[model samples]
Target chain A: MKYYGGCDAGSTYTKCAIVDETGKLVASVTSRSRINPVLSAQAALDEAVATLDDLKGAKDLAYLIGTGYGRNKVPFADENISEISCHAMGVHVVDPSVKSILDIGGQDVKGIAIDADGTVLNFAMNDKCSAGTGRFFEAMAHAFEMPLDEFSKLSLKAKNVIPITAQCTVFAESEVISLVGEGKPMDEIAAGIQLSVAKRCFVMAKKAAATDSIALTGGCAKNHGLKQAIERVLKIKVVDLPVDPQLMGALGAAEYARQKGLASAKA
Target chain B: MKDLKHLYYLENLLQDANNNLVREAQAGGRLAVGSVCSLIPEVLLSLPGCFPVRLRAPNTGSIDLGTYYMTSMSCECCRALLERAVEGGYKFLDCIIAPDACAQMNRCVENIDLLKLCDKEKFFISYSDVPMKSDETALRHYVKQMRIRVLEQLSGVYGVDVSDAALRAAVLGHNEACRLITAIGEYRKEDNPRITGYEFAVLCTATYCCPKDLLVDKLRETLDELGSRQPDSGKNFRARVVVAGSEIDNPDLIRLIEGSGALVVADRFCFGSLPGRQEIVLNDGEDVLLQICRQYLAWGKCARFMDTAKIEERQSYIDELAKSYHADGIIFEQQKFCDYWGYERALGSRVMRDDYGYPVLSVDLPYAVGTNAQLRTRVQAFVESIEIKNIQGKVTR
Candidate 1:
């Protein structure tokens, strides 16, 4: 009857995951950009507790782990781990064969290369620019006056895609508007946008030597067009797990907490 | 981790050497060269058996030396330079040499040192009369004072028997190293680049503390081996980029950038073009160390040292370097926690756009190896933007 809880507070969104002793995903929740991370973490904790109706009144959680950008800010967590390590561990838990994991979040993108045991060998990240991240796509969606879900769908329909050149968010927005004015089809423009993200991701993947089975996690992975575009350019099929990709970081943190808890008990 | 520990030890040794050199120079009553462009005078000090250390702060510390200056001391680099001097890091020196190369360095001497606000117990202030016109008479006078002061200092510390032959050889050795580094830089400009700008900088800085013979031989071998390696195919680069920022010490970042098919042709970092070029010439039997020291103090354009109209001048220099190198883009790398270049970010970006009509990418780097994917994406997209499609005679869309 042991219980484990995890939290992942990212720049754009915060996520939480709960798993039982048998590794069953009991409950998971995610909140958008507005809430403060401390509050967001509480919301996620509440959601996890609510999912376990029979164990709702159970106050005895075996272990809790906090991770991601705001892991240190999580007050209730028993321990904390870096998102870089947690993401690798979480992805490996889902598919142990995944050697390379590319996590594209709202503000940053990371490429992690891991060993069979889920230990990070070498990793690279991109936080300085927003061109290749979820934020870039969000900005593009805003310019097109489309919801993110619809935008991804429309992108798949483009007969001819026109590439946007500027890496800057402001400049790229203008380029999209100019393309719209030139009577370019919407789907093609969307495809071009996906292409841009893919190009940046490809550069990172090549640097990390994205070898063997690769996992695509993070908020951007939900985009069908982006996933397809990345797969095509990399010339490799990317594995997506059934568990919510956004929650993987938190799950890994929880798993780490569980292991530490068990080791201390043994000691 | 072992390499990092080794670097830590090396840094400590440099700091110790700097302190001892400054103390010996001051005790012997020699003038210190403290200008960004005072390479000649710095060399002269070394040749004359007097110590010449660049006034810089330890990479970490909380002492606010710039607090003694006025509110107008907004240039963080200039403020940091003054702070280093005030922190008693330069307490061992006999004289503080100030070159009038830049406005900030000039002001630091006139306002900070000349005002007698700094700790004056250890050092005197000597200003070089190197006019913008490069006056020979002024150079001779400065060289004479340098020699007399250094000789007096050597007599007190290690005795006056310091051989002129040994000093000349040291000066020639350093100058030759600079020549070899410059040659390496020239090699980087080829279509199929052999070495990177950051690697070239490492080779240059390693020479500062490393044995002269070892460095010279190692560099010669590296250059020969580099020359034999096949060049990167010039076909893939969507755009050529010039990288500028604080000294890029991370080899991983450089490899990531290069692997993205963008050749870095020029840079404004400490480890790049700065150390390679030889701008100062030493006169025979004219105290080679002093000549080099004075030139080192007078050299401007480093972000660390501020000069009159330096912002505009640096922009122009970057523009010219980009044009000469045929760079298609420019990446402005600003290290996190470095307050000096953060202020220059906006202006630097404008300079790249307005002056050169090139796309400028601003990268804020952390100490850790992060930002690889994001940088790759930004660079690739930039190249893809300018990608040209060749249309053969058929059209059907």
Candidate 2:
């Protein structure tokens, strides 16, 4: 059976997904992002291939699509599609009922409205700001001196919600420190940070006219606190994807490769 | 697409406010009347022995000083212009005739006036209270302001001719340039356009920045050259779109949009051909100044025109342009921090998509869009969405 590959060279990490002609995701891998997207993409694909018994490397793939911030820089990509389109496709393929998506990536947050067929009907994104993104959460976690997963878990134990007023990441971190100095509960502050991000994302969702249930994608999608906060602020349900949320971009790219590769093969 | 011969020459002219043609016009004993807003009737400033050079600070790198003075919260276009002034960029102009519109721009001009930046011995700045409402009362106020603040000032200071005959002659020259620019812009309506949006932007912007009479010959030749120009096979663009928004003195925004696979079929923004380059139809019976003011008032679609009728008309105008040009979608953009366009873009984005049944991409852009990756990504995604809709046979108006 022929195989397809997709690489998502995001700002924080490079993810690769390999799929068979039937669109089943056979193997996938994630690695820390390198400064150069090409190197990161190659590394991720090679790591993914190492997980399989038969596949050797990218050469074994029938087609490959590159996506995310470093999409154009992926040298071996047969095609490069924006992460917005890729996310929409990835989510639609996993769950067609998800009409909207909140993709909080490394540096930016996006609100995407999708059609029944996974086409991106409309989208809205934060411009040159990092208030509601993976980076923001990572920074907060770093300030709390804990791992990201633990930081997100700490948010669930909060007894009160402290509001984060500063829109800038640096300022918000300073505010978090001041709150710590004030002897406030760490879990409450953590919940506040998640809620701030959620509030910002709610504005984007409103702007994009997101409706029905929305899926959470990107690295931060794993943060249960953020998911709950998004649902609370948006007053809508956040649906779960069958696959890992962070792999959506790569999966969508791989799906496109499958479709395109099959069409060319038929021709 | 093949480059228009005059494209390079005109593009280079836009790099500096004091370009070769402006110098040539000044050296020939003509006054350079600097202008900032469209409400300041361009024809009045282009009277005999004077020409209007709409102030633009191209290749702007840092607006630190501008930010210090105007504060960072002011409109970036206003800040950039102020920055250029602080850098002695507008030293070539004789005077500035601006509308008392948009508070940020007003503060910018006020700072320039207060600083005495322009060192010309007879340098001056005139502020005219142009109307926001385009009614009969507004027309009279517009005409009266143009007479005293713009016309009388030019005639008084530089002894420039502001007579009815002079205004008539200026209108003729302005109309000639407008006709050429409009005719060139019309080619974008073709299924496969002969001219790219970037080239058309350069041509249209040149008419605004340089002396119209000086650029007329080149525009005429360029327009004639477009007659037999063939478009590329299968089309390079994934979709055709109309760009509507705030002032786009810099064409890099259009280039960025086009580079993302959307062919800009119509321009409905400031410094664009729609309202800026349309011919000023004249009458033999009425006063030339009164007639000019009336036409400009009617054409006012800027968000500063707070009237409910004008706001509704603005949306209708975009719909008409999109339908006429056969555009697949519309891109509503605004210069960041521009309060007028900020609200306009937000409202227009919703109305155009929900009411008009068009796929609209709304964005707020910086003044100089130099390969902004975020904007490019947005445009690329917008193009893909439009393509997908087309493939799905969705009737996107």
Candidate 3:
């Protein structure tokens, strides 16, 4: 059996995954903070290789593909693909019915509409601001004095969500603190924060004019409240895989590697 | 401020200007000869007794600024020069002059003429058909035509003789100003590094039409005072940065960057470095004014101009400066509505990183008041990342 490796070096974290030719995720690893993408990518690749130690001696470990904000930093990769194409490819590989993918990372957010063959048809990205990404939630988490993981869960329990006015994170922080001082419930504030992010993402999705069955990726996808908020605003069903949401870029990269390997073999 | 003494001073200056005896006295009793750009006409007009200022826009930055203007993009240099003209900053001028260098600049000339900043009779719009690659014959013809226009304008305005001697004297005065500027710039690069680029730009702009002797005296004093200052002795300086931006005249941005622990060492800006040391090389030819004009058009890289070779040249210049000055990074400031720098963002970043092996942090400035705190955070984060990279032994080419 042939094996392939994929790495996604993002602004906040580094992720790696290994898969067989059949597209089964044999192993994966994730690390905190992506200060130096090249070094982080090397470390991630080593972890992926170590996870598949049995497959290390496999004769047909054909290709390595890299993608993401820091995709160019992955020196060991045989090829590099755009994160948008990779994200759409990964979403389609897991769920072939997915027509649109909304991937929100640390610094940027992108909404991609994919064709049947997993080609990127249309896409819109928020490159200018951080309000549309997981950074918004991270800021809110900091404001709440809670871990990001716990904050994600807390957002789901709000009964009466109050809306935050500012789209900027700094402005929103002052607004959030003011509301908190006024005796607003923490869960309600969390719900409002999720709603704000959803609103911003909705604008991006609308710009891309994404079709039905949108799949969410990135570290923010782990937030169930954000998922619900997004679904509520867009009036569409959101899709997810069993693996960690952050692994989507790596999964997409591996899928690209597999497709390229098979095509080259046929040639 | 509007006293007759100022007028008398200008009149006496004009009188001294007419007599070759005054020129000889100023030049240590010799014919003072120098060169000046065509744009010197405008600088000349801002004086009390001279004709209008005429200038040609160098083609560059047109596409980027045009995109911002959209339906009004016109030509890049034309738009930039016109925008500056329309700002009414040169209200002191008797009139402004422009040449039909390009269609866009011609349009700009027409638009500027429509504005009532100065006397309409003083406005002289000359059309020159000199090609970019003009031959000797063509240059001579152009120079003759230019001389006629200069004589006519000077005679009409001040009733002074626009003889070769007088023109030569004016050119010499301009050259002396240029020499002082070049000296100051060279002095800044030495052990003390006295005057900053900002102060240098101010001195350059002020010297534009001011009497050569006055400018020289002021600059000499300034340079002396600056040279006497001691070098700053400090370690743990976070990072030395060169800030390049469009219209970074706003001191707030500088304060914000400095507050973030980065020392701004050099810059490529209209209000910063371009105005200083852009000397007119006169000894090469008799048509020194036109030569100066061409040199000014070709001298530096601006958002309003496009020259890939020049851009690379400037990049290398900055890189060398950064290395010599021990700079850590480069901060590119792109103002909103300034589309040229925005389009160059990705390419500029790649060049700085790939070719020069230096990290670049780009900040897009909005016209609105107040700087974005998020941008400040990002800058801090980038600095921290650089520090981390150094600590981890990963900093490399």
TM-score top scorer: 2
Pairs that clash in candidate 3: B41-B53, B42-B53, B53-B97, B54-B97, B60-B304, B60-B305, B60-B306, B61-B304, B61-B305, B62-B76
Query: True-contact fraction for model 3?
Result: 0.00
* Poorly placed runs, candidate 2 (over 4 Å): A49-60, A181-183, A208-212
Off by over 4 Å in 3: A1-267, B1-91, B97-167, B187-215, B235-237, B250-252, B274-276, B303-308, B367-375, B386-397
Q: Which of candidates 1 and 3 is the stronger one according to DockQ? A: 1
Q: What C-alpha RMSD separates each model from the true structure? A: 16.3, 2.1, 16.1
For candidate 1, give the lDDT of residue B68: 57
* CAPRI accuracy category, model 1: incorrect
**C-alpha lDDT of all candidate models, in order:** 0.63, 0.90, 0.61
Best by DockQ: 2
lDDT (0-100) at residue A252 of candidate 1?
Answer: 80
Q: Is candidate 2 or candidate 3 better by TM-score?
A: 2
DockQ of candidate 1 against the true complex: 0.04
TM-score of chain B of each: 0.58, 0.99, 0.62
Q: Write the per-residue lDDT of candidate 2 for residues B328-373, one digit (tens) a residue.
A: 9999988889999999998999999999999999888777778787
lDDT of 1 at B14: 42
Report the C-alpha lDDT of model 2 over A1-267, residue by residue, as the tens digit.
Answer: 888889999999999998899999999988889898889998998888788777887887889999988888775688888899999899988998888888889999888888878888778888688778888999899989999999988888788899989889999999999999999999999999999999889877875577667889999999989988888888888898999999999999999899989999999
